[model samples]
Target: MNRRLYRGLREAILEGAIAADTRLPASRDLAAELGIARNTVVHVYSQLLAEGYTRSRQGNGTFVNASLPDSFLSSGRRARLAAAPQPRPALSPRGAAIVDGASASPYQWGAFMPGVPDLTEFPHRKFGRIVSALWRNPPPDLLTYAHGGGLPALREALAQHLALTRSIDCDPEQIIITEGSHQAIDLASRILGDPGEVAWVEDPGYWGARTVLQANGLRIRHLPVDEEGMQVPQEAGGEPPRFIFVTPSHQYPLGPVMSLARRRQLLAVARRHGSWIIEDDYDSEFRFSGRPIASLLGLEPDAPVIYMGTFSKTLYPGLRVGYLVLPRPLVAAFQAAHAELYREGHQMTHAALAAFIADGHYAAHIRRMRMLYGRRRAMLVNLIERRLGADWLHRDASLAGLHLVLTLPPDMDDLRVVEEARARGVLTRPLSRYYADPALRRPGLLLGFACVPEQDIARKFEVLLDSLAEVARKPARAARA
Candidate 1:
């Protein structure tokens, strides 16, 4: 009788039909209900308590343990062990790299994130019309593999757009439509550097590029970024890296436009070193300040530069459209690489996006979003000033991109602040997470304001303020003691 009662309760608890913290029925009442002896129920409860399945609260009744070990609580795991062969960790050189980092909780607060477009303002109707138009009258050539260079019309349109807007003089033949800027980077890495070779990456730069380069097994030399963009080293180091990836247009998370002189110097350095200058013109399209800065590619048209840009930031991520304006010399090589990598052309999407650009709609959309985003950026600055008063961080914040960085107090760890902020229902990231080394860590939060609704900015800021106060108060009170 005792064994039967034990099995029933164990099964219920293990299957989670009876949840943790659920109180068991009274021993005498439960025995009668189950048609068992009262002594049987008592004995079962005692065994459960001893085995940590249940706990007694002295005078109160027995309850399921708030915490249970896996062996006793998970029936599926036990069943799996009984039936199939148990899996073992992989034995490899980079086995540890296969493990994933901790995932962020969704309910966390204060996520001043970056690289997100305002979905609320996405031109769905305009995009929908273009996509539908393409499907209605499909191009037969598009049904087969697209030309390695990409959709001819799209390449020509992109060339014209770059020439007029960015002063980048390029023949459509030299332009290769890529999946995204990341693919372009990967291609450049393969063409220029052998595995285990070196590449210069900006310090406290975009970790996305860092991860990609490292995954390819290339050694990375971290260079510091100043206000004038990636400061060209006074002397090009020996056996200089074959590739140097730079985001000269509003440096990621740092928002510093590269100076014209520095641009020339960078080109000179790359040319002299025989190194490839990988230019990521990611978000230069939406400039609120003065005249748009001509790309480094424009500075030396004949020089070796692998120009890459993405519509992900400008348009939307799901569109998956980006292009590379390669040097005339490397275009054929890249085409061969493209042929090996991509079999089916992304022709339908290419046609739709190309048609959208040709109709003067794409230009208009960029202009409209530029103005709207500028207003939102201004509103954010105003909100911060009005609410925070003099107690704000990063006063000289740049007015570009969908997000900005707010430098934290020198002693206060931004990582700890991010964790505490998450506890209070706000999602945010620390600048340190982006850095390659702890020594290069900047104590600050990377706040992305683009995706977040403008109306909710005040409420979110208030929550952020409250969290900051909590973090600050603890140290202050402790210091006084």
Candidate 2:
């Protein structure tokens, strides 16, 4: 009986039926359940432990050893392991496409990694104090699921902040808190668009939005973006898009603030086509230029625009807090959809964020970071100019945002340069990867300076310059050959 029980348990463990570290049934419990003597179960457990199959913790039950030695298993169990490796489950068509076309970098936070904020500088102590205080005397609703768009206090606080800073015209009722801009985009795409519907995305735009919109079954049209912002197509293609996605305030990677005239043109286009515009106002808070650029939603009252903003860039990315300022007409629909789709929670954090904004910590932090990032940006730009020269690296005229685009020769392969830079501990994103069409792709590098320290910028950038020099030498050597 002991031998039979030991073989069964070992086979179960070896076959992966019982996963590693899974606690086994107590000897007494198993003895009673299986109608076996307690002495038999004890002997089996002792034998298993002696053979390195299980571990007995002091005062705790026996658990399967996480690391199983190949030779420790009996011959009978070894026979089962000799079979061919099982094939992985096949993904759906959409899932397969998403995995194949994924562009997310393995490293998110590093020197010169774009779109990441300086998390080290975050006021964790102050935020912790707020969290601790909330936990001490937490509200009933705070511990429960969020009702109605989100916490009223947070929406009101955000509404006031947006109005003062971005000139957005919105009431607290119009605001809907989201997990992040990604979720906000997903909700907007599904609620506003149907499968096979058209959606216009800015060429060399945010890849994340494109991925989310495409995943929701929207056909994406890449609209060209220049100094003025996303250009409105001269002639209507097959059908007007259900929505158009734009990064109007501090355009992603490129950093072009949408011109007032361009904003009006986009609004006009949206009205003509009866299309909803998703204005992704990412990283607009850290502008180092003139007065803050007004949002497209605020430009024209009742414009068909769904404004999305995230605290990822402003605060820490892990906060998972973002919002959507919807038009009054669409508020009810969005709120209903948000509840149905996301089933939002995180009330405690929402309340804490509201207090943070109300107490003026949010604005104060932004102000301090803006000054620090400005110095870091200037330092990187100076280093690039001094080391690589203006002829080799042409820095784009951008005064806002965390990252800057450095244009290279048209023939240069930015992707190759990016890979070479990565080997030297400098992270960079190639500009060509952002474009939907290969023909329109430009060779450029998106160098992020916000997260990197002002002092470290020169050293890390010098490493990048070395990679650039090597890339430049390759073309010359090939030409001689």
Candidate 3:
């Protein structure tokens, strides 16, 4: 066997030049092309087969093996790719395209990330107690197929909770428990709007909602959010959007509650335009700063708001318990959608959660976490002030959510800064990564402080500062270049 030919062909397949399962040219044909003897080609093929790099069929010729040697896969390919240049993701003809971009490094120093609740103090004992109780007396309905609308007990409890907490007027029958608020959005996209119809989303929004809307083939209009929450533009180009998704309780990523005036204005816009609103009250329970703003859905009881809430943020992400309180008209459609999918809530898990909430334990746990997180949040902000100084950066920070936004210096490359910090074992999200238009890429960091303790914040921020400093020192064109 000609070692050179064998190795070269092996490298080509392993390097993805000749993709997996692609049929290789017959030995005679390949030899003729390479200007080599048929015997040399045959010998090369034989060796490749022996080494499991190619599979040869009796009559049909050879195919590139899906699996290949690591040495073959790594040989000069990555280096060549590193040198090759590529364009940004092409915009999809449909609408605001999700450009294939790199996410912030998973490691962060004092990560000011949003939506992540603290896992350390999750009242595991109480949850276990509820689980034990549920196991002892499981609901008979648990064994039956779900009729699209979820567990009756959970629905009733959620309706009661909403009425009591958010002042939302809704019956258990009008509610449907979804996998999470994410699925609720998906369901809303399906039932509320037709394909290619416009649906409004928050500008610096929840990416999950954006993703679901895009996946469902809805054209998304990015409405700007401010201190008063989503400023619903009266004239949305020409035709009105079918639906608008808003997080009025605490606008995700920004953490601003929708003021009463704006909530009324939004509802008015929805009513005037005959459009529906998906109210994602993702973490209303964890409001650390102000009095809980009443839900927009509650404000306009019979209005066109599809109120969505999730226990994922309040209790835990793993629980996957969330409910949508729909307008009376859309209830049938959502129920039909649920039935079509044969979607049933996890009976055992929901039963446990129901018990947990039913007992005063859930309230007690929230009370504990609120205090713990309040201290952590205060400590995080103080450390940021003491370490970074207030005047050095704009402190237009939000007081409610798990994380806060910090504006970076104009010259900084947020993506690169986050990457460098992550290399030093700190993770965070660059605000730019969330934007569709490159011009909207604000140079800033979103620090998630819920999961990490107070003692670790200073050390993490110190490492982050070092990474930022290193990035700052590098020539603008050189670091990323």
lDDT preference between candidates 2 and 3, better one = 2
Span of ten consecutive residues with least summed lDDT in model 3: 101-110
Candidate 3 C-alpha RMSD relative to the actual structure: 10.9
Per-residue lDDT tens digits for candidate 3, residues 435-461, read: 655555578877777777878878888
Query: Which one wins on TM-score?
Result: 2
Superposition-based RMSD of candidate 1 using all C-alpha atoms, in angstroms: 12.2
Clash pairs for candidate 2: none
Worst 10 residues of 2 by lDDT: 388-397
- Tens-place lDDT per residue, model 2, 1-481, is 8889989999998888998899999889999999999999999999889988889998899998877765545555777788778898999989998998899888888888888999999988888888899999888877876667889999999999999999997899999999998899999998889999999999988999989999999999998878878888855688888999999987776777788888988888889888999999988898787888889988877889999999998888889999999999988999999988888799999989999899899999999999999999888777767866765443335688888788888878888789889988889899899988887888899888889987788788788888887888788448448
- State the lDDT of candidate 1 residue by residue for 1-481, as single tens digits: 6787788889899889999899999999998887878998899999999988998998899999867765554766778778968678675644344234222334422345567677667788998998988889888988788657688889988998998899999899999888887777777787767888888888778876876677677888888888888867867565577788898878876778888888888888888888888888888887777888888888875977888998997888777888999888888988888878776388888888888889888888889888877876777677767876534546435567777677777777676777777777666778777776667677777777766777777787778778777777778447447
Pick the winner on TM-score between candidates 1 and 2. 2
Off by over 4 Å in 1: 1-79, 83-88, 91-95, 98-111, 389-396, 423-425, 474-481
User: What is the clash tally of candidate 2?
Assistant: 0
Most accurate candidate by lDDT: 2
- Work out the TM-score per prediction: 0.77, 0.83, 0.76
